[model samples]
Target: MSYSTLPRIPSGWSQSDSQASTSPVSPEEGVVQSVIKIPSTTYLGVESTVAPTPQFERNTADLTSNERAALLASSSSAVAGSAADAPDQWAWRDVGCEARTLGRLSAPITLAASLQILNILVPGMVLGRLGTDAIAASALAMSVASFSAAAPLIGLLSALDTLCSQAATGSSRPGLPGIYLQRCLLLCIASFIPSVILWWNIHPIFIYLRQDPVIAAMAAHYLRYVTFSLFFTLAFESIKKFFIAQGFHHAISLVQVLGTPITLASVYFLAVHPATSIGYVGIPASVAISYALSSLMAFAWLKTYGGSRGWTGLSWEAFRGWGRMARLAVPGAVMVSSEIVALDLLTVATSYLGPTALAAQAIVSMTIQSSGTLLMGLSAVTANRVGNLLGLAQPHRARNAATAALGCGTIVGIVLGVILYSLRGQWSYIFNPDPEVHAIVKRMIPLLASLLALTVITALSLGILRGQGRPKIGAYMNLASFYLVAAPVGFLTLRYTSMGIVGLWLSFFMAVLTSGLGQLVFLLRTNWYDQVLKCEARLAHDGHHEGLMTPENHPSA
Candidate 1:
């Protein structure tokens, strides 16, 4: 069992000679021992003496139990270590990791979205109780304010989504998110000037665009109150992104949850109270107050909680990154605005069809928007994960994250499509009691299903692109799909065919499909190693000196 007890070699051969014979030798005879020679007869009738090289011994009986155990354990550990260190290949192997990561990121985001939707819907609900005319005015005001003010501002501020997420993962500075927040706040304040002018002149603009004079005037009145909340709303949005990038998504959800009741109560008191002369303006004013409160609460949490580690306080450092931020913000705003414009145009097209068709469109639009909240949550998760991976210089994992996001989005889309398809007959009734509108919705079920699926995929793709710091690509795609393709198709179909709402839905579906497919192709063809280098360069430029940390140097690597 032990080496000392092994049988001794023959008298003429030493231990070294035996060991040499057991080991492999070259073709030359220098390393061979003469004692191991063998006589051989050649095939050509020539007799010769040749030495046969001995095969290495497979038997391990010469070694002790302890030595054998040690060798086996070391070999096993080496194999496991290599496997652990190996880069992920393009495959569906890591579904569990992907699913878990997506779930962790999605839950809070979805909850926050639900609360946000409640904030908007509560005001509308409260205003509906005032009177038919009041409800109509409120609706007009919401539409105009959303398209003219909310959409552009939200779009512009979206730049922080990329910057903060990337900065959190990529920047060496602890206060990057705070700096981003400060920069965005400055931008929002500057934007407020033009927004004020637009809100002030909305009545004339709406009239010139052939809106009902009474509704236009009422909407202008509504915006005047809501305009005060603009900066606060933008501030809330910026801070929300700041929290999200720092992996503090739960805090945002909590803030929104806490703010919802305040919003509802404010709206009720202002709109329904007899002594209050706020009237329809109270709805927007309540919204503004709710937003401002949410921002303050989130800010308080950031300061009191450990989130303030990133807060260096107001400094000139906040102004240093305006150019980089603008480069992204402007294109992001355009990208978001293009999509909004397309939807608005679709709404316009629906209007010409009749009130019934327009009503049906509204129901479908609300349903689609609600369903899209889930995708939006997933998209935020995707961006954050991808940005984090890229920041760590793990391109393979980043690729894996992106592909996994697409897969998860696809699975979610399919499930959603199936559920929506099954409920298509009765779903519209939740939004509209009318049988005719339900019928139109029932008829458009297939288009709705397709649109939902496409929307999920496109949203995930856009998120990945944003995380990669390539929002311009998304902007260009939006421009091409919405303007060059969907718009023209929508116009031609509506003008020449009796397809009505179906035609408009089809056009939007095509646009989404085009964008999604284009992004997928780009993702597949991307040289991720190059992206890793670019990510490193970005981080370096932003004052992060931890340039290109390899697997050996990275803590997680």
Candidate 2:
């Protein structure tokens, strides 16, 4: 509820007048954030020698990935402090190295993220056996659940993305990461109340929205039964962040690798089998159980072998930072949930086209969900890699890395597009045996493929902004693209025209295009040399000399 007047730098970023006289960060001043999220990236960028800018003093916990990266990058010039350590000056090989580094870090993060998504996808696949209505109904249930559950979780926990990693730098306050972990876990629980209430009685809302009463009722039933997984999944993610914050980035990947088979098998026994199956209800029940088991195993690790970096057990003090966290968390959520809501509304809108079209939307959405999560993981790595490059004051390399990240993300997107296209014939069958869903999915493949590529490019574009410590720009772009552009396009295209489900995706395409091109042009015009100075200014103002930079803490990847 409190606000203050902060000075503005000539570059338009807020700064403090006092930092105008602060000294530049020396090479040995502080440690850089090592490791990647869930997997660490190799340091390979260089520094700039411009005069330092004045950075504002603020709460480190409230900063996003780019600012945190700037602060850390300014604190240490270790990666490219010498020409010997510098990446081969200005070669295409530089681009290749950046791509490879991004790829290596991206694999584990993508795999683990995909494994978690299987909890949603596998259920849809199993329930698809129950016919098209099941897919349509489950889609509705999940659309609401995602808004209520997944979106909110993403927002509140996004603070931890910056918070825990910043806390772990140099192990200065190991216990702070633990406190953050506890705070995030507690916050997720406290915030789920509204979502749970809505899920418990969402049928009326759906009915009022003109959703088929039968699908609404089925969706409502599935949500009511599957609600148990919400707490466990949130806990699993929080604990995963805890491990990542302390440098055990591989822990969650191990859990996911072990959990995937259990998830697949659970769906078979609890929902798919003729004798053991408990019909539609069993599909979601199995998902809940898989999530529960994953959470339990993650917690067990924390109890037995985890917490070595900074944990000293839970503290009551964590309860106090909700307001501070909320200030950061809510905006992060709004940025993320806007996209989620837009995407879900597309699905919800498709419901009016009947079970056949709704079923197709389900397949398309889930397919994209799993694939898109992978690209999203890649985007996280892009942000961190750029941040690290900036930390070394490597404007040239940071720019190159940013370019390389776009190239890498595009290639991955194209490949996923190919995969989505190639499997267009068979992909729908993975979720449903119906030929009708298959036909609709096939028609949508071309648009879906293009959307995939655009999505990655756009995501990587924003990742550069994040690395540059300017997430608000990306947030604003997202808000405008999704709300002002996509919303009207989608509504009119769907309601006024006969494009059917493809119109929904068309709107998504326009949104990503608008946001992506906007960010791309901005990054191209940016002054990288000044960005390094800004990084130094950020750390100077944050006032940390020996931060807790650890191997485990990075961004959300």
Q: In model 1, what is the error at residue 194, expressed in angstroms?
A: 1.6
RMSD of each: 17.2, 9.0
C-alpha positional error of residue 344 in candidate 1 after TM-score superposition, expressed in Å = 2.0
- What shift in Å separates residue 469 of candidate 1 from its native position after superposition? 0.5
Residue pairs with colliding backbones in model 1 are none
Highest TM-score against the true fold, candidate = 2
- Those runs of model 2 whose alpha carbons end farther than 4 Å from true positions after fitting are 1-79, 82-95, 114-120, 302-307, 383-403, 462-470, 522-557
lDDT of 2 by residue, 346-371 (tens): 88788888888988899888877776
Model 1 misplacement above 4 A: 1-90, 124-140, 272-280, 353-357, 432-442, 544-557
* Consecutive 10-residue window with the lowest summed lDDT within model 1: 43-52
